[model samples]
Target: MNETQRREQLKKIIEESEPISTGVALRYQGETKRVCVYRIPLDFLVYNKYNGRISSRVKAYERLNHELNSENDEDRELIEKLLWESKVERNRKTMEDLVENGQMRHGIVTADGVIIDGNRRASLLNRAYRERDKHKWSPVDVDKCRYFNAIILPQDAGPRDIQQLETTYQMGEDDKLDYNPIEKYLKVRDLTDVGFDIDEIAKMMNESTADIKKWQRTLVLMDEYLETLGYEDMYPMLDRVEDQFLSLSKGLKDWQDRSVLAKANWEYSDADIDDLKVIAFDYIRYEQEGKEFRRICKPGKEGSIFQDRLIWESFRDTHFETMDAIAEESVDEEIAHAHADIDVVDVLRARDSKWKSEISDSFKNNLKYSVRRLDDRMEDAKPKEILKKVRDLLKEIDTEQDSFLNDEGVATLVSEINRMTYRLKRELGQ
Candidate 1:
């Protein structure tokens, strides 16, 4: 519905329908006010594209595809699909509850009928009404599902307050849980983009100001990682790496602020940190995380390649060279040849598999060599422990292939290994 039509419709609904009473308390124009709830026809309301629950998904999808117009039926359907899928199992249970018990909690919408807090529930209501027969819903249940029970704000509601109220109410402790982690990060970014300060965002999200700043900083690094890999603004690539990014962002910040390691020799520059980001990005790209991912650059000498100048330079050069070589080939043909019914997610997954297959071993071997080199500098570290780690890495890789012999990096690394082995043998006086 257009703004004018919804305004007129809301006017009639407010005048004719008896309100269910003041059930919602909201912060409006810097004051707490209780708004009466009303039942409005579903047609008068539209899904909010920037709802925090799926904001990142919507953003990533729109960037990859096109902007969504909520007023358009096709676009509404697309938004509906995203909302439903954002938390599929939970949404399904909520839909079932709506069928059996009706809407227990009221939603908050603007006077012009844009839902501020109940996008998923609203989507589920619409879905339930559309598929009433499939669920064998009764006539009364179907009718009840047709109208949304919500607190409609005054017509003067501005976008700023609306967004703030939406953020506060939808994600409030008393409201729903199970939000996508990415949404919180992107929420801070979006609200910042629209001119909300960190304090304001923290208030709205019910998070501490420090945490809000941290999330924003982490989001910046995430964006840089995406842009570095030519996947700018595509957040689905970060599906399961939230924890890793948080650690990496903190690590990078620590190094930048310190310039030198806590107890190590090498001092780092901004350029060096950027190289570390790319190296971590590659490891993250190929399914490395936790201790393995942290060992790459966790801000200390104990297994960090950047702790020593030589290790840092060798690792960064080897990593970037391998990465550039991998990026030399185009995957557009393979993506284009995917099955017609294949989805973008699957296509991206296939591309990811292709990348991991081609680059993971090189990334791993280089990291292992660099890590061992760092350990070698630790005179207190046991040789047997380091050698055991090397043996494990060797067992995981096959060196007998003809392709291995042909690889210049592999040959050079093996030569270095032989030289080190000769030194150890001569020192033993065999």
Candidate 2:
């Protein structure tokens, strides 16, 4: 139904039903008011495409398939699928509860039938209505599932007001815990696009303005990452890497202001920062997180590849070379020629996994060697411990001419060790 038709249906329903308070007061027009709860037919309302649980999912879909029109059958099915898949177990439990108890809490919707709150409940209501016949259910439960119990907003409500109300109900309260962390950052972006400032968004989300600002910046980093991997605007691709982005974002922030650094041997420029971000982006794409990921880009600390200039230069050169060696084997060409049945993100993700699996040994080996150099240089490094490790390694090597000469790298290192030992003996006056 169009907006006017939906509004008219809602108005007629509200006029016929008496307002049930249920002791719930909704803040509207700068005042708190107890609104009437009317049973609106489920067909009159559309699931919110920007619903917090599936906002990024929808965005990612629309990014590739164009904007979704919920009025369309296929699009509606897709939206419902996203909602259901957002939290399948929780949705199942909610569906069960809905079948048994009906809608315990009233939802909020615009006069034009856009749900602002209780989307999950309304969705489950729709599900119960459709699936009622598949299972044993009470007659009243089955009948009640056909309609949604909700408070319809007044006609004066604008888009900004609807967005704000959605934020207040869905994100400013307990329900926020169910939301994906990436949702807030994208929500901030959406809210800002709809004419809300940092302070207004902070107030709506119940976060500090500084937090909103930081999320905005972090969101840009996330966007850049998507664009870098040929997945521009596919926010769902980041579903598993929120922590990686958070850590990388904080490191980038620290990179911007080195005054906060505790100790550093490197003086980096903006170009260096870009390199750091891109390198970290690669690791994030490969799903290397936590301290393992930090060894590549953690800021204001020693031992990280970027924390030391010499280590960074060598690591960067080798990393670039390694990436270039496999660049031709990436899934981009495959994605380009892929049959319509294959998912692009899945292919790219497979590419990342394959890439990590292929290069993990070399990647980790280089990083470990660099970090070992850093450890050796630190003021607290134990010389005897380092020597003992060297001695143990030396004792295990085969010094036979055939075995030693067969391995060129071992032969080179052994020669260098012999020269170093001779110098040490002379220095000790042996």
Candidate 3:
């Protein structure tokens, strides 16, 4: 049929049926006495949001009947079928398998009523009930079910009581399905109680035997400190503790007593202990080789001995100036060359020899003139004064010659000459 005609036909069929029930009463038949049901159209049921309409009990039955005939399943089954066809089909399929294998259960109840128990089942049932007509719904068996025997509280119970009961039921009935190591441990614990071997449980949970055991140990260890450390801090330590436990050739207690694990005790804070644990393992593996830790030198710090030596060499080379000069007229070529040598003793000896030779040359040239001048002046006037002057001049020249021949005296003279030459060159800008 076209869209308009189909909608019209649905409306006509609904209008011709009895209205949905507000309140239902059971009546017994003769003998076998199957229950006869009837409806009361209270204001609450007349505007019911569940089925989107108010009618007699017969209309509710008709809706259930139509769903059963069309989907070929009972009310609960039809709801489940529709759920499987919805967006959360995969989760519903898992739930269906759990239900089939007696790992999960199903139920139904009023929205205002306390859940008491079987809260997960009730929630799933309610969702299926609401989504029965959606495109995603698919049929499944709902006959196999499990429920807790619970005492229903009075309608006058306070909201607090209802809320408390709901929370308790959810906690008690809902499977705490978290994909964490703790959750896996809990699951393994549950499985173990039912006679599953540790290996079998590990296989089922997709974990190694050692991994499972480590998790168990961690759970025990962390239980005492969980309140202090909290999950945020403790989670990353789980894998580290596992690795440490597995890597131990000896018992876990031995590993714990080892210096490595002892050193790790301070990492109980939100520190990344895994990286530290790996480092500890590496240290143990290569302990004989010695650990090499980097020493960071801060900026502007003085350098090492080798670096200081290099710097000193560079400074000495670029700043210190040494100069030597010799006059060819003052000393023989060999003596002058020797005077310019870095060795002070050799230069001093050479300078003394050169000075003696120069003094000898000066004395020989002036001695004859000095004696003749004295003789010529002797006969004139003041002959004694002329001879005394001449003798004094000769004595002064002889004194100079004797001093030049002395090593210490020659050394002093050369030093004075060097000083004067240096000063003169500096002033002349040469």
Candidate 4:
């Protein structure tokens, strides 16, 4: 039989047979790849949004069990209310679409019925069943959802198996959608927190170990920085801005290294962390600007600090005094002071307005310093070696001269060559 016929056969088997009890030594019968449908009671499944104060599936089950067994009426009521609301919010859209189409896909569950996948669907069906009698206001028909559909796994499936299967079902499927950065980061972090080794997670998620570590590190540091700034509760502010946080991470390490190395010490100083805190706050504020901040921090942009490693080095080595503005007592105080005069956006824009000129000036000064040193060396060089070097330099100059399409560019190159030639003659006593 074809696929649809097989599914119909499975549905018939489910309807004719009694519900399979949990903890049974269930074995696969008939074909191994056949889809099996079971009408599981709503209480048998669990909801795990992978967020909130309860961080893991185990924790969610614990709260659920507490609600099921609690002697205190108030505690049970509160937990029940929370579960209902959370499930409704998460599953409402899926429920609406499924009912409208009158079709549902297969969901996976363990024998003990901790939903490995499709908790939202199960939750919606459960809600429909619970409210079936309250027909005066119920949106979903209770008669249609007396039991939830699922493909129950064997009794031996453990947490590792569940995690692996969920990851596969969510990420490995051809129809898989790209998760937003924050969701991806949180999922990886959650897996790590639940005792999955980095290499194991890398293999499971099809990501490099370094990539996994980078996400974890960025998340950990971002949380610490948010907590430092008294906005730990506001961590969702980082959603969709992983690049900014990653850039801050790199910038923080660079700044710390420079500050510590300047003191001739290998350990991080308290002042270094303090400076980092301020910069971290600045970075988050910049991220808040959304598109404008992205424009300034765009990787591979013309004069972006994030794009140009050399710009960061130049700022660190030469323009260190410019960052003194961020060296305040606290991020809060610095932010307040920043906004006390001009708005933060205006302040940032003003700095961006000067960035090109500042970078140009710094570049010219460094070039001038290099030229002076080269002049000193040329003064003492052997004439033959000098002539060979000058000839090679002239060849390079000629190659570049072909690309100088503008009149101003040609004039500048000719003038520079003349100045260089005059210097060479003076040095060689010509």
Per-residue C-alpha lDDT of model 1 across residues 1-430, encoded as one tens digit per residue: 7978988998889989999866467678789887789988899999899888777777767875789889999999989998888889989999989988989888888888899988888999999999999889888877788889988888788878787788787765655457877877887776787789989888888889999989989988899888876666677778889988987888788788884466557666788878888778878888787876777777654556667788788888888898778653343565467786665566676788888999978988897777767767766568787778777877877778977878899988889998998898898896
Ten residues in sequence with the least summed lDDT for candidate 1 = 326-335
Residues 341-413, model 4: lDDT tens digits = 5533343334433443444454345434433333434356777876787676667755454466555877797
> Model-by-model lDDT, in order?
0.81, 0.81, 0.34, 0.51
Residues 379-404, model 2: lDDT tens digits: 46676788786788788777776768
The reply for model 4, stretches above 4 Å from the true place, is 1-35, 49-93, 101-103, 128-142, 171-180, 194-199, 206-210, 231-235, 250-277, 289-430
| Better-scoring candidate (lDDT), 2 or 4 | 2
Question: Any idea what lDDT model 2 has?
Answer: 0.81
Residue pairs clashing in model 4 are none
The CA root-mean-square deviation of candidate 3, after full C-alpha superposition on the true structure, stands at 40.9
The best-first sequence of candidates by TM-score reads: 2, 1, 4, 3
TM-score of each: 0.88, 0.91, 0.22, 0.49
User: Comparing candidate 1 with candidate 3, which one achieves the higher TM-score?
Assistant: 1
Q: Give candidate 4's error at residue 201 in angstroms.
A: 2.5
* Model 1 ranges with Cα > 4 A deviation: 174-177, 300-303, 327-341, 382-430
Clashing pairs in 1: none
How well is each residue in 194-224 modelled by candidate 3, as lDDT tens digits? Answer: 5656675565445578866775664554443
Q: After superposition, how far is residue 9 of candidate 2 from its true place, in Å?
A: 0.8
- List candidate 3 segments past 4 Å from native: 1-126, 133-181, 192-197, 203-206, 227-255, 259-430
